[model samples]
Target: MTDRIQEFFRQRRAEGRDLGPCLVVDLDVIRDNYGAFAKALPDTRVFYAVKANPQPAVLDLLARLGSCFDTASVVEIQQVLATGCTPDRVSFGNTIKKERDIARAYELGIRLFAVDSEAEVEKIARAAPGSKVFCRILCDGAGAEWPLSRKFGCVPELAVGVLEHAHRLGLVAYGISFHVGSQQRNPRMWDGALKSSAAIFRDLAERGIHLSMVNLGGGFPTKYLRDVPAVKAYGQSIFRSLRKHFGNRIPETIIEPGRGMVGNAGVIEAEVVLISKKSADDQVKWVYLDIGKFNGLAETMDEMIRYPIRTAVDGDEMEPCVIAGPTCDSVDVLYEKQPYLLPVSLEIGAKVLIEGTGAYTTTYSAVEFNGFPPLETHVI
Candidate 1:
């Protein structure tokens, strides 16, 4: 760890007081990140994915930073609009199926949406006739960590048929969109997404159809205690491939990055309530902590797993300790292995301030079975 981080941790611990398990969003960090990302794409426009964090402050910051939004639901759209962003600047990027949702977005003057199937197109045609739309094409299943080929997005082979359906319905099929899944380490992964989009656009052009926009869906990760692809480098790299395939004369290039935007801006502060030692063997000891799979680090498809932890908010020095969460279930664990601070000792009332929780930390915990109230969040 850097000396500055260590000093920050030490200073906070010395001045530490009492606060409940709360989440803190460093708005300054968010603005700084926004500025950096914005300066990188000097010519192109950006659409921040609202699904990532959706803090109104974050949305307002994004608008002020000169980025639009990629909203999934009417609630998200309304949230963005409430931030004073025009619907034209916002794209309802998720696949629209329900008539009520579609009708609401159209009623609110939302123009562009993602179409994955004929059924969705038919629904949109009936619900919001003439509303401009984008067809989401399937990514070639090569480099995505979570390849969306099987579940959502239209298959490349079926692009013509879908576009033809849109034309037949007299709908303004305005563009195409594709997601290369999340935390994409390989910029080359976008090569497939770019190729698929260009191929479909060309085929559609052959059929005398033209599109005006292209939404490259968001998954850019914020470098929170780790470095992968810097957004600037990734954006430039993606743009190069994009220009190569579609040339300079193409539709508006839109990228929706969610986690890449606000993930580094927040951390969750939790009070340690209990500590217990589990003995798998004499040499194997697991230290249980107060936080668990619920309040933080809960985004697991099936089982809860802790990511490699870094510096805590308050660490005088480094020590080896295992962290676990406070829940009735045995799965309420923060780390199963590795070294966290032991604080020279363990006490019940001590705290753990976890970083990189800006995405899905608070109300992100959705469970009614345990009868737990939602987490309280405060921004700083």
Candidate 2:
């Protein structure tokens, strides 16, 4: 958390305007993050994933910084364009899309698309003829907090056929892509994916279809409760893997960073709604906030993402507590399998600060769920 965001919360409370849970994002932090990614991988392009956080201010800032965009839908493409960014700088990175959406994106001047199946290739060829198409392969998602595996990407052997089919159907077989996973902590994970990509590139070259780029899909992690490696470390490791696999002919490369780009730039301020225990002999207290899975903190599902929660009573006597949300749904629990440690003095009406939440919170928030408004966002 930064001083500016703290001051914002303090002022909101002072004015009695802190009526609900809200997210505050520091634009200065985003600007610095963009610079860091650009500096670390100087040769690679940065495509800010729109799905992570599609705030208009965030898009406008990244556009001015010369960052490209990776959009998942036609609406996202339109959102990026509304920022005065040209369509050429945007990639339709979602492998699964409606044919109409492909036609719409093509009409909007989006020539680059992602595909993992011949059926998808056919749809693109019919709707977006001669567009550049990259094939995504599956990874095991070994070390990521949010593993993105089965829903997207084809096998490497199948990707060859998919790209070749695209070539025959009048589409440009651009290159290969794969996501190691989201919130990936290990820098070495890129090596195995790069190796597979190199093999695909070579196989296609023999068939007279040379590829030109490698979409190093987003897996870069942001600091949460556990510390993560620096972006420079990932960049260095990826560069080394590129050299190892492709020798001197490293293909033109790009990275789609979602969490790593803006995750640390935001914080959430929530109010402790109630604090109670289930039984007289219970040692754990249930602390409920106004926000929950249906409202904002969906990433806490399956207890995969553990957010750092801070309150004024921190640094006092601490104990394990079951953190929950104010909603009536039984699934509104935030942390239960692994109880969160909070100060024993924490009480109702206390304001809590949740850090490392800029990327996923606002976008994941539900609309009017349990009559709670969506997570309010302020880009400072």
Candidate 3:
């Protein structure tokens, strides 16, 4: 906590104003994270998943840092283009195919794509003839703690069939891909996915469909509130396995990192709305902030497990408090039972800050249920 953040808080406090559960981005932290990924995964084209946080400033920073774009929809493609990314540098990485979305991306000169089914192959070939594509395989089915097998992710056996169909359509079936689920806290997950990739490449050879690229969908580990697997080491171990199994026949690698790049670089600042306790016997002190689940940080409302949070209370009194948000929804709780400190004797109206709202906080939110305007954006 440098004066950079502290100064921002201090300035408003002096002006008789408090930050109202506002989200802030730190360009320095983001740049360092991006640089670390680029350095670790040498020669691999890095596409910072745009859906994570498509703030104009965030995208602009990515472009300036030489990171590519991984977008899943037509509008996402348009947003990447808006951030000045060249078409070839962007991949429409979602396996679900929308005819109009494919056409739209093709119109923007998007070359690389990903798909998981025969229906997708038909639509892509019909809409964008000769487009290069990646067949996405389902790693762990949706029945796990998190299930993504619902709409996309072809099974490994089905992947061979899909690749065969792709080759027949005269479209360039460049390679195969698979996302190993998100918020992955374990390095072993990569081992499972990369091993599957090796098997797929060999199967593709047996089926006569050679690929030119291998898209390993992002989920390259990030620690939130708890220690998770290390990102750089996990990525390297997987890369080593891919090379070992496939030799030089391994296609060029591509990755899409969202939270790993921006998760730690942002924080939220909210106003203290209410502070009270349950009852005489129940001594769980609660402090409510103006920022609600829908407003300040919707990630939690959606049950998004973020990093362990550290709090900043306006005054210098440090005591444990149950921090909540201002949403009308009863389920609008943000952080509970987590050790958060507020000044011992705080005023009725105080301000609080929560860390790590960079990834899924802004772009994927519905913040204006009551006509509340979005907060202003600054590049500091």
Q: Give the number of the best model, judged by lDDT.
A: 2
Report, for every candidate in turn, its global Cα lDDT versus the true structure: 0.69, 0.95, 0.73
Model 3: per-residue lDDT, tens digit, 1-380?
Answer: 33466666667668965545566678888898888888878878888898888888888889988989999799888887897878988999888767988988898898888888988898888888898988887777321223344466877888778878878997887888887776665555656666777787788877777777778777764556656666678667767777777777767988898888887777666666788888876556787877656664666644456444444435466777776766566776766746465677675575555666677777554547555445433446
| Winner on TM-score (2 vs 3) | 2
Model 1, 114-219: lDDT tens digits are 8888888898899889888788887654543334445668788686678779888979878888888765656667777777788888888888998677777766
Pick by lDDT: 1 or 3, better one: 3
The list of candidate 2 runs beyond 4 A from truth reads none
- Candidate 1 segments exceeding 4 Å error: 1-19, 140-149, 280-284, 300-322, 337-347, 367-371
- The TM-score values for the models, in the order shown, are 0.86, 0.99, 0.88
In candidate 2, which residue pairs clash?
Answer: none
The better candidate by TM-score, 1 or 3, is: 3
RMSD of each: 3.8, 0.6, 3.1
Error of 3 at 265 (Å): 1.0
